[model samples]
Target: MGRILLPALTLICLIAARYLADQVGINGLPAPVGEWIDPLRLSEAAIWLCMAWVAKRAIEVALRRGRNGSDEERIPSIAFDFLGVLLFLVAIIAIAGLVFDQPVSGLLATSGILTGVVAFAVRDLIADIFTGIALAIERPIRIGDWIQFDEGTPQRTGRVVEMNWRAVRMVTVQGRTIVFPNNALSRRDFVNLSLPERHFRTVKRIVVDFSVPAERAADIIMSAIRATPGVVPSQKPLVLIDELVERGTVFSFHFWVPDYPKMFMIERQVVENVLHFLDQAGYAPSYPKLEADIAWQSVSEIDASFDLPDLLHRVPLFSKLSEEERLNLAHQSKEVQARAGQALVAEGDAGESLFVVLAGLAAVHKSVEGKLCRIGQVEPGQVFGEMSFLTGEPRSATVIAEIDSVFVEVERGAMQAIVRENPEIIDQMGEIQASRMNAQEIGDSTDGTRELDDPGFAEKLVKRIRLTFGQPG
Candidate 1:
């Protein structure tokens, strides 16, 4: 686009020089033509220099702010720069012939062999430069895009951090910068991971014995996926029966993540949550009698080290149930654990599981106007997540583990199973939920928090609980 300036500048200078020379007689020279021509040549060169200055400014402005902040229009503008330089070189040759009176035809004739040698020597370099120009124009992969390609090949992988005339630079996931020749990049196949929303789907497979009913096992896996923070909820997770083998059935979990960089961390959390859920369901890995105990506890399972039944007995609400019943409830529970400072239940997260704190301490906090205010402390045997667990609503507060903690989570199905047998447990659970609302000394009462014990609060709480738990009102 800026190439027009070079020709326009040259034409104007030519007309002005011709007018000056014709109007002011040249025959009044004091000395020889060549000696005096040097001074006149300098003056002509000064006029050409002024034109070059204008062309330079025009080219710079057009390249910089022309379109999309320059990057989108980088290719065309750069091509203009290349063409302008070539034209300037041609002008230099003309100036030499006109001002110094050199042989214009002989110079071109003698330079043919030299030009061929230079082209042959820099053939690859020239190809790479032109190839870079082509890529800049086409923009198959722009800067800031993530890509992957064959190792040691011309194709580059990772994020494109640099794009220039000779090469494309990428910073790989491993923290290495790779500079690929532009010509080489043109010859290879690469995957551009930035297209189509940049959402990456990952598949995780788990093997389980035939004893676990397919539907039941799938539910356990799906629950873990739903709890995972990285899983994109917009794309529903898929649980598929991938294969059946002598060992057991292979279940594949396919989930989409918004960011691909956090894939490994998300997968780790899913695997841990799934394994914990499986462990609580009596899939303790043991292999003493593989054939005989295949349907029940077998050698293939890892024994869940946490004593869930004993822990459940420690809770006052479960005190009415017998040891056998506690064990049954424990088996139905999904074991969940969290590290210090990790949230077992985040405020505003939709939850269906009632978390019974089995070990360690936790801090309960409510977000008031975007600021977290500590509401209470949860000791062992205390239950949280009950609001969302029984009501099918979001969590009322965030519970973070004060230390490495353990929890036996009873989801809606497991809670329903227990309530179907014992409806009285609902009243006791309701009383506790009511107590939390009415309690005066929940942590940080110094903020002068008002008691939430409104009239008919317990009735409303029990009503919602009974409805969600499938009890007759």
Candidate 2:
């Protein structure tokens, strides 16, 4: 609306001027005014130019409306700019022929010669302008698209921000603005990360020791990628053995990221989480080594790979427990393996134990409006089901294994003695459970901070835990 205001006002003023010109005859006007007005036909030329501007604005507005005002479907700005220039040129020629009553054929021929000379002098600029027009029409890459312009070492990736007559401007992932000449851009091969869909598949390769079974490694890596936040979970991410080299076995991980601009952030998170999961499972990435005997885990790290106590140490709920208490809990706990799609716990079911994910992934879901909607994911080292275990309430949410998963289940039987010895541990457990409950109730907070501790809720939770375990009031 703001864009059309100037042109609309100009058109109104031109119409008024034409009306006044006719009412007050040029012959009755002063000598110089009448003399200049008749030859120049100033009023008529002004009216023609104003009409052209108004028409251009109207056409642009109609194009936008045709797309239902969707930013993704709106015509590129370069298209409108080119259309305006073309319309103004046509209006200029109309003024020469009709308003001035002059033969425009000769004028057009002279303009053609002048244009040829200018085109020859600035051929590169003309080429860029024409190439930009072609790109605007073809739309191989649109504004807001992520593209790779140079695919050499240290590849160049940027989001298209603006396209004008001679150049395309993009802001890189590093926040640097880069301008590429349209003709140059058209000549090179480029990749549009956003085309087909904003979600695109990417792969990462990691080397694991040959000592680790390829099937186990593949399962672990697939679960790690699937558990990541930005990954498209419904697509079922895959992992395959790519090669066997001197270092070890190369495994390829394939997953779809929901957006291109977020690719880097997601990649960082995937790597960090994947490595952590592998470490929890007692594996490490193998480096190029010539030695025939390659140890997968060092002597110090071997216990961490297999010991239940080591896994217990990583759980946040057990953070307050002493080393001896954790070992005692570990002695009584049992390891359970669940296949993909298996229900670990069902909503409203009886459960007296909490489970900690040791490998693979699981999803937390609850019945919302008669539909089971997924609420969260469980990754390696994370604990779940404590509310039902501590309070003996019906399971508030159902948890299902997303992939072949391993969990260490600690029943109330295992924890009874530990809590009885140190009642203070109940306070810490209450604090942790209260934070989890707050997170679920609050959803994700925009401020990037969660309610870390809720004393009132914690106090109530402690009582529930004591009652559930038959501890003293």
Candidate 3:
């Protein structure tokens, strides 16, 4: 109601001001030439004031509606801006005609001639003006869309910040605002990152010395990328050896990220992860000789070792056990190494052991008929074969070593012995097993046939329970 009344009040004030100006009589005041002041005519003032108010109201309403509605809603802003300018011009002409009492025919002729001359002189500017109107109507780029323009040489990549009649303003990655003429934008080849969808694929590449084996390099890089916090699993990050450069081998890390306004942050994170991983692996960016010498001296000769005492001391699962119990469990565990492309476990095979990866990467694949289909990959600090060990079920998937991998294998009998002695271990195992099973079930139910409740629903139920009983589940 207030929104509606404000424009009405503004119109009334404008009319009053115009009339009062015309009626003011200066009896004893000396006025300069061409400064004759008089209040506006009643009809003329009313029309002018009303037009101004209506134009202002239309602009406000259009902007509000545009923001609240779909992309199509923004079309009205262009109409409002054009009509508002037209109405304001009409009000000015009407008021001027009333003030001087001159015929409008002569004024129209003069204005039309001046407009034609201006248009002829500034054809490019006029084209840009019309192009801007077309841009507004078509909406090829919206506010906040990430776009790349002028692909050759030094490219201009930025997010659209504002659009106006003459030009579009883009805020670049370097924090500079560039104003490009609408006509120029229409002529250039531009890539709208926000078009069709608001998701984009970003590929980052890291060059590592060639001395690092291809398989080992890929494993380290992929593991680092997957472990990076902001990265999503759905994007399915891929690490490929793109090319062998003069100085080193280039590994292309490709993944999809949300097409956000500030994409430089994500790019920075990817680069940081790549550098961190290479540093951890003791590999330099350039020169194979240095990396080769370092690998040979520090890593190649290190014998396969699994510190049982350290594992029990670090892992939460074995933390509760006493030193003697940890030692006993460690004694039962065996260190196994599988070379690249080796199948550690086959689907439907009888498995009596659960493996905890200590280092290197493996993939979990299922044999559909005769061909192996990769379901997922496993990295360090992850465990597998728990389903077969706990339930004595057949191995659900084949675990294949993607790189030379090492793991600590605990036999079903040894795990059973440990759990039998410590019943608390069974409860902990049940919780872990339940979480994994739930995740697997959710992942496998792509056909919408599963009846499991969503986590959001469960969270709501838990919140209600907490509110009612003052305790949480």
Top candidate (lDDT):
2
Output the TM-score of candidate 3. 0.54
CA lDDT, every model vs. true structure? 0.69, 0.79, 0.65
Q: List the residue pairs that clash in candidate 2.
A: none
Put down candidate 3 lDDT per residue, 29-134, tens digits, no spaces: 2466325643345445665758676766766665776577554234434445665677777777777687567678888887998989988999988787788888
After superposition, candidate 1 runs with Cα above 4 Å error = 1-60, 70-84, 90-109, 151-156, 233-236, 264-320, 327-473
Query: What tens-digit string does per-residue lDDT give for candidate 1 at 1-473?
Result: 46456656665886587568757865334667665555466656555555555566566666556655543234433355565566567666767687668898888889999999999999988888899779777778776677778742333457777777678888877788988888898998887776656787878898876666565566667756766677888898888999977677789999987754677689999888777656544343222345643445442242354457866675544666767778888888886777778988787788888777554457889888999877776654567776677678777678887655666787778767778888988887777666655664332222233335568778787888898888987
TM-score of 2: 0.72
Question: In terms of TM-score, which candidate is stronger, 2 or 3?
Answer: 2
Model 3 segments beyond 4 Å from truth? 1-6, 10-46, 69-80, 90-106, 120-125, 150-156, 208-219, 245-249, 260-262, 272-473
Q: Kindly list the per-residue Cα lDDT of model 2 for residues 282-384, writing each as its tens digit.
A: 5689876666875666533643345677678777678888889988998898878899999898887888888887778888887878999888777777777
lDDT of 1 at 37: 58
The whole-model C-alpha lDDT of candidate 3 against the native structure comes to 0.65
Highest-TM-score candidate? 2
Off by over 4 Å in 2: 28-40, 152-155, 288-290, 294-336, 344-358, 363-378, 381-399, 407-473
